[model samples]
Target: MSVLVFAEAINNKYKKSSLEVVNYGAKLASSQGSNVIVLTNASADAAAELGKYGAQKVLNFESDSLHDNKMLSQIISDVANSHNADTVILSDNSKGKSLAGRIAIKLDAAAVSSATTLPNLEDGFVVQKSLFSGKAIGHYQMKASKKVITVAGNSIGLEEMGQPVAAEAFDASAYNATVEMVETKRVEGTVPLPEAELVVSAGRGMKGPENWGIIEDLAKTLGATTACSRPVADTGWRPHHEHVGQTGIAIKPNLYIAIGISGAIQHLAGVNHSKTIVVINKDPEAPFFKAADYGIVADLFDVVPRLTEALQKFKAS
Candidate 1:
């Protein structure tokens, strides 16, 4: 049976997390000697990019109504039924988790979320996932007719398996469900944390919310998004959207810069997947130093301005 991957996108452009999921799913399909099918609800030319990631066929479900979770789940269920897919893969984004959960309930398939690795073909299709704030890895097996998995973002890297291949269109009208998209709230920013290449975060060490301008300036200069530790949000020093910890958003940016953060276990758990970590703190003995790629022991006020100015000079030169 073929493996089906439900790719997520925004404004017809595929998210970086979706590409990682496609790569993971493609490898799993290869291991099982099965073809890979990448599906998207957007009408844009998303299919053209899937082939480079080893997707043999791309299915496009063009409809504005299918953007809602209820409608999207129905469409995915239909595709899974039509192809008799053995495995259905999705990225562990907010939308992916909601859609995958509903699809799993509808299909009665074995479901696994936050998967870090693909299933082992020789071991009865067992998938490995993180547990206990990434303190442990657990393997699970699917015994149902179809297997549904939501892959953790940034856990797997993408590779161009081949050149772009032509994809075929798919019709899933029969399974369309009733749903309405009355309004959409969009957050305006340079880039979303999950999709950003670089992220600069501040914590309680910033002292107060008024001091956030410095962090924002650095993020602006680097074209990075801003995030904060849990304490900052709890103290009302930052909004909840900027919170990044065990209870907040889990991000996997290419470069994560944390300032004035103690790097607690819960906080580190959320950002441990970053490709590079830079920590700025006055406490040289802080636990964050161990996990940081670069650590500076100094007051943030002095360091941040100097750092920003140096970066500006370097950029100018």
Candidate 2:
């Protein structure tokens, strides 16, 4: 089966999630005795860099008017058809999920989102995914010979297999964008929270934005990204992008450290997919303790400094 992987670029750079999808696609392609063909909008040099992650050939899309999801989907489907790619791979994010339906319709392929495991061809095309907000795992079989799949962020490790790449530009400059992007303003942060594996998140319990220093201190020492609950974001203590809850961004980091968060169901909906949760809340009945793998019923002020100091010493040693 021909496999195609789309490495979406933003601001001329590729996100970690993009590489994760490529790595996953490459692995799936290898299992079927094939190689990955990547498509991206990044610079030629940056596009070629995907080769180190098992992309044999890269297709560069040079279109500044690709603000419409439909337009992007059409272009991607065209490429898939041109390459005879029966299997299409995408990153499990908002944009990818939105385009998956359109691409599936265009290609007459089955589409699955947030897939946690590679397809098991031994028993047809079985893939595993999280269900019920990660409370359970569901294994599904794609009956269609052709399928579109999105890999969950951080589900697969990035593997570097150095090789020279030859990239060709796909001309899509003439395509008209139905939804024009007037301006793009990104939230500047240490790490892109979606792709972060280790995230240190807090809530209103941090008191005010000034007290966020403790959270940042620990996160910096641990090399983890920082996030916050919706209440904190609504209170103007943290940027809304850092908010993770039912109405905010959903994350499935490997290690999630929730400090001073009460862990409402709304907040848990977004982060319950985390592999391991460590909650640091002084309140014994903070509700977060129920879902935490490790709970520390102590003031964050006392614990955070000591934890950061211990980590610093360990790293120095």
Candidate 3:
């Protein structure tokens, strides 16, 4: 009856999606009248922070094989068996998706991904998920002794409900890892687009890379990450990491501001999960206007500078 949450840490802290999944697991555990446990690759001391997100116990596995999905799945499966946990929760990210299937196979459990809502325990173990790239919702009833669920990003809310609990050490050395450790490259300073609350993005309409000063200024003013559409990234106007579209990175920011972008369907797919969308374009018939919560029909050259100025002034005041 216990629920185990995989708390993936990024840049020495828990990612937003992982925290949200932990909260969701906590709620699920509460519904089942069981305790929620969190497993992490972070230091045992750092796992204590997860307790505020409603984790009753945190299991910290210190290993260099954090990037090895096979080893991680083996660790998770072993922990689930040890605790007799019926449900395992993870964020629907790359690592989670890869590990979930393996864990399910190893534990002889049912695995569900892209879950948007919590399971309905009153009836059968029915969970709601987004299908066809978030165009539709599908409800699935998993009839298995154990279950693995990977929750969608930004689909659930986070609430802190408990005091910080000490993290216990977990030994994962017994499991043989198929992959070896390699050099790690860590990107620092900038806010990760996936975890950002606010994002300022642009597209080809901005003209060229030299004109990116306004976009950067606007992002700095709003404390937001900077993103670009597929075309913009393709043309090298911005780095590929800044790209947001069907073929690029998917984001779910609280506030998304787009300038000089025509909002193609592919681009919209990546940012459609944003809570508030603001678009500024010269074309009145721009497709982005249709999806924007706020639209301004004006030249971005004129509109962006003024907007950035206003934001800076407001912050100063």
Candidate 4:
């Protein structure tokens, strides 16, 4: 009944999504009186931090093939098999999606993605998930002896329940690639949008790239990450990395403030999971208002500056 959690580390650090899956796995294991074990390539010190979230042990692996889905899956499958773990958990993000199927195939397990709730053993191992861009909820039952689940980001909160412990080295060489030197380019920002707790986003209604200062001001004042709709990115008004939509990066921030963005279904598919939505648009008929917890029907040019000023004053006081 042991649970194994695969929380991949990137750039020598653990992403918020990684800690989230570890937290989820810890909760699942605690319920069954089983210890949680995390598999990652993070440094021993960083890997040991998982113990604070109830992970009793960490299995550390290192390879230049971290991006090789097949090789990473093989390593994970081998580790899980050796541990005799009945359940495996990972994030439902791109990397996790790439590896989950292959790991499941190797282990002869049933794999499920976008799990919004923990597996319920009381009801035949059912887990809840959202459907139709969060328009509906569905519960699935995993019937296989082994289960592989990809947990939705921010579906659960983090908790620190135990002391830290050192990570143990793991030896695995199912597959390794030989490659030459390559140049890498990264989009740099103050806060990584995917893991941000607060976000400020705009769209085509912003009119031009010149007007983005207000959005940036608001984001800076609130210490939130900045984002934009697809069309805005397509027009070169904002970097493609800042775009949030079906065709762009998905996010599950705690508070998502969309300014001048018309909510298309494609855009909604990416951020519908956010805890709270605030839409600011001049058109009262805008579709974004329907999904917003708070809607402001006013011109963003007039509203954005005022909002930022108010927040600055609030913070100063």
Most TM-score-accurate candidate = 3
TM-score, every prediction: 0.91, 0.90, 0.95, 0.93
lDDT of 1 by residue, 1-317 (tens): 88889887666777778788889878988887888888876663766777788777888866544457887787777788888787889888788888888989988889999898778768577888888876778889877878899998777777788667666777766664566568877788578776777999998888999999999889877878889999999888888888887889888788999999999999999888788999999999889999999999999999998888888888889
lDDT of 3 by residue, 1-317 (tens): 69999989864577778889889999999988998989988887778988989999999876534678987888888888899898999888888999899989998998899788889987889999866554667899999989999998888787888889999998776888788777877568888887788999999888999999999999999999999998888888799999987788888889999998998888988888899999999999999999899999999999999999999899999
Order of quality (TM-score): 3, 4, 1, 2
lDDT tens readout by residue for model 2, 87-139 = 99998887889889899999999988999999999989999998876668889
RMSD of each: 2.2, 2.2, 1.6, 2.0
Question: Which stretches of model 2 miss by more than 4 angstroms?
Answer: 208-210, 234-237
The local lDDT score (0 to 100) that residue 219 gets in candidate 2 is 92
Choose 3 or 4, whichever is better by TM-score.
3
- Candidate 1 pairs with clashing backbones: none
Residue pairs whose backbone atoms clash in candidate 4: none
User: Which 10 consecutive residues of model 4 have the lowest summed lDDT?
Assistant: 177-186
Off by over 4 Å in 3: none
Evaluated against the true structure, the overall lDDT of model 3 is: 0.88
> What C-alpha lDDT do the candidate models reach, one value each?
0.83, 0.88, 0.88, 0.86
RMSD of 3: 1.6
Off by over 4 Å in 4: 63-65, 173-175, 178-183
